[model samples]
Target: MESKTTFIIKLVTFYCLCTLNLFNAIDIYHNDSLDDFLQDHAKKSIPKDPKAGKLYDVSLPSNFTGMEVSVVQLQSSSVWAQGANLSYFRVPPRIYPNPNVTWLDLVFSNLGNWSSYYYNMPNYTFVTPILGISAYGVRHAKGQNGQFTSTTTKLDLPLIRHPIMVRFPSVWLPRGKCVKFYSNGRTTITNMSLSHTCEVWGQGYFAIVARVPSTHHVWKLWVIGFGVGCVGFLLCGFVLFKIIRFVEKRKIQKMETESEKSEVLDTKYVGHSKMPCAFGIRTQPVLETDYFP
Candidate 1:
């Protein structure tokens, strides 16, 4: 029994590891690629000295223009004290990065036009672009050539003291709920805390979603088809009515011709009326019985 239990445990562990590795590989499609792009730009954009704890914009390729990318550095101590309230994001007080860090590199992304291309919410439509927040460990490593290099390594912020807030830009449409999309393919819809704000516990991509009222288009198409059918039905009825009238007139004309052909009398026009007259007496005036006496 002990041996069997140990074997089962080993099998479960191996399966879990395989699942995790496969999950990580799933990011090659977009998530991982976007991460690399953000980090690459950050390396070039981070100032040699902190700019008053202000955010610095990360430049992207021309094709990726209009998508927002910015980074801010905050000391973990300060974050634990007053909380890190940067642009569009609010981390409540006393929530430090997991695995602990001296300084946290906060990277913010707003995939404007590229939002739908990178992510999708089926059966729902996105009214706003996808917004994301990621935390990375600040690093300055000595290179082989003796030059210090700046880099950011992704860190896990597994715990939160309170709900984090994300504010999206204004959108004009039906109000929608906040949709949170996890890396592991889980999704949740949270009610809007404000008109355009959402509260979340962990980090991942998020956007506002409205229900896809598919029946609206379906009903529109049905109404159009019904109207067309009604018009066709009316045209068909009109043509049938004309045909019936023509057939009735032809029947009357045929009866009149038959009567003319079968008549044994001569029809003469007497004044304004037609008079049917018989021929002159046949075989003289033959009586029913000859009265020669």
Candidate 2:
């Protein structure tokens, strides 16, 4: 009974460890708190009567120190004709909303320290924070620019011609690959147009990631396979050599036995015994030339 209980306990522990590893391998990331803050309080930083086509910086509190958020309001005609370039991002012209709303608000965010929690790239490390841009519909008075009204649902702004150009300001950043992450764990790798720029079709999270340099990699699959192959080959070669030696030894023993049977005798101890001898000459000595008496 004790042995059975111990076995059950060990099995359960093994199963639990496997489950944990499975979860870690999946690497799902979603933050409700960050989403709630962006949807609610992030836009409040904009001035009540802000200038249209101008960028407004969203000031976050001390707890969110490294992060940055900004917003810009644009008219439909202006967005359609001349898309806005709000510092870090260059929104190209010929952009239209999906549902066709009157005014649009573009909110850009840079999750500095919180990037790792919200995003992950397996076997890679992030060189920069995750940058994101989202568009929303705003209810404002007709014919008035950036006037009084409430914010509406999120809008989908699709580009007609050139893709959205996102640039990281620091030019001296280390070289890395660009990866754009979209909703529901979908990811797309993009090419950098400039040294610190990545073009995108629409809004999503973007970051630069680089593969982690290895200091020491032990117990890897390839390493194990190579080691096993070398050991197996050596073992096989050793076995073949041993088999050949054994066969040669048997053949030599058989030859010696046959020689002894055909009247070859052991060496006599004349002077320390080196040469073989016949038992008693097998037959009388024959005359070599018949002239011998």
Candidate 3:
């Protein structure tokens, strides 16, 4: 029974130690490869009539020398469209603009269902109008379970003239689908299965490609700070340990010195003429006696 209890205590202590260490560790992702990949992606031209829905490209505007833009196409039945409908599509959120940017414009067109409404099937057609620069296009074929066409959209952005910290936009979708766009031209997309009712049905996909300003220095500084903090903490602990050891050594030395002094005093007194030795023999001087004469 005692051994069992000791084992349980050891297990609990080990678990606690592991939890502490895990909390102290930091996770960092190397974005060098991602930077190179997005850079290459920006150079590639948009392909014509890509069969799949995730076909899109990001690049600088041909006429605008100082601004950046992103061209995206969201296909029907894809992960991003599962929770998207006419209402959601009309005013799609701006997912990639930094706060420092002065202005933004979004333009979209619905290639499908426009002709049907013009040809007298008004009830069957989806009503869509340009809602300022933030309009989004939706294309749906007749009798199709998913949107059969892609909604091509363009985003116009102008950055602030001065140097400032910018918060890059991230894409959020239903079912735990999210994409993070970094200022350093790095993009990370995370997709996880979430339990929820999907509003849109079909195999569709969305692609957002942009070349935002790089913020590599910010991340580098953060990592460096974390590393410096760890080193500082370890150094402090080491110094404290040394101080404690020095204090203990001084105490031991002082005790030994006091003991040596006590022994010396005892020896000196024992050898004195008036003091008695360990055997109880007294050390006394005898006067010159008559026997000596």
Candidate 4:
């Protein structure tokens, strides 16, 4: 019993260790900062954005005048539309200018009617001096280098797309920014000031979209999964322990009962010579002699 209790205690301890490690592993995914904090490495800490002071609604609010829109061009061919891949556009990394300022990369192609649509569309007729700023940074491959390592930063503004001048926000552009504008389908770096209002030339249009943070919901899911996994593991361990103890108790009882039966038989046969007297060797011998004669 002591041994069994010891085993159970050990099992519990090991389980606790494993549980701790499992949770620690999960925490690493969510809070690398915690590790740095523990080791007194403040440099690696995740910096909070002041501009995004609090969680805000993704959709532009009623009073919002600023808007950004991304238009999808329908492919002339099929269900698989291949146009501008805007997934890369994001709030630039910390090292980049205005990490809060998310930019989209606009790609032009000749497979569709881009320039022709821009020329004919009345929506493209809007003309006011607006700055068009472009910045370029090196794209990195996974596991190849530090998460962020960009060498070049050039600012291209006052970019002329067509008849009108499209300017970039001078306040936003810095030394390490890049922009390339092209008259044809080619790419180039041109400058445009915010003072010059212009429209983009393409079959598509853009509108400012609202931004909202989704961390809370994601964290909730993680917590739920973690709790479920921990409880499941503990329940399974407990069930297994119960099954083992039950089997062992039954085995011990069976052995004890068998020993008791053996002792009783030995006691009855040991001194009870009178019990064999009726069928003893002498009586049997006498009956056989008579029959043979």
True-vs-predicted CA distance for residue 205, candidate 3, Å: 4.6
lDDT of 3 by residue, 25-120 (tens): 311113223222323333244445433333243563232232222333443224122312221122222233422222222222221222121122
lDDT per residue for candidate 4 within 1-293, as digits (tens), equals 57988999999999999899778655643442321222121111213222211212223223222422221212212111222222222111112222122321222112111223222222222121111223322233445555655232221212122322222233332222122233243432233333222234322212111122367977998899999999999999999999999999999999999987766432225474533222325443345354654
Runs off by more than 4 Å, candidate 4: 1-213, 265-293
Using all chains and alpha carbons, the TM-scores for the candidates as numbered come to: 0.61, 0.57, 0.22, 0.21
Number of the top candidate by TM-score?
Answer: 1
Clashing pairs in 1: none
lDDT of 2 by residue, 1-82 (tens): 5798899999999999989866743443353335446655556877778789888888765556788888888887898888
lDDT digits (tens) for residues 1-293 of candidate 1: 57988999999999999888777545543664676667678757888787646999988766566789998888888878788788788878777787677988888899888788678888888988899888888677899999998666788765456888888886765368899877666889988868778888877778888878688888999999999999999999999999999999999999999987887897789999999888777677657876777
What candidate 3 gets wrong by more than 4 Å, as runs, is 1-176, 179-201, 205-214, 217-219, 230-234, 237-241, 244-254, 257-281
Local distance difference test values of all predictions, in order: 0.81, 0.77, 0.35, 0.33
- Runs off by more than 4 Å, candidate 1: 1-31, 140-151, 216-293
Q: Least lDDT summed over 10 consecutive residues: which range in candidate 2?
A: 24-33
CA RMSD of each candidate after superposition: 14.2, 17.4, 25.2, 28.5
Higher TM-score: candidate 1 or 4?
1
Q: How many residue pairs collide in each prediction?
A: 0, 0, 4, 38
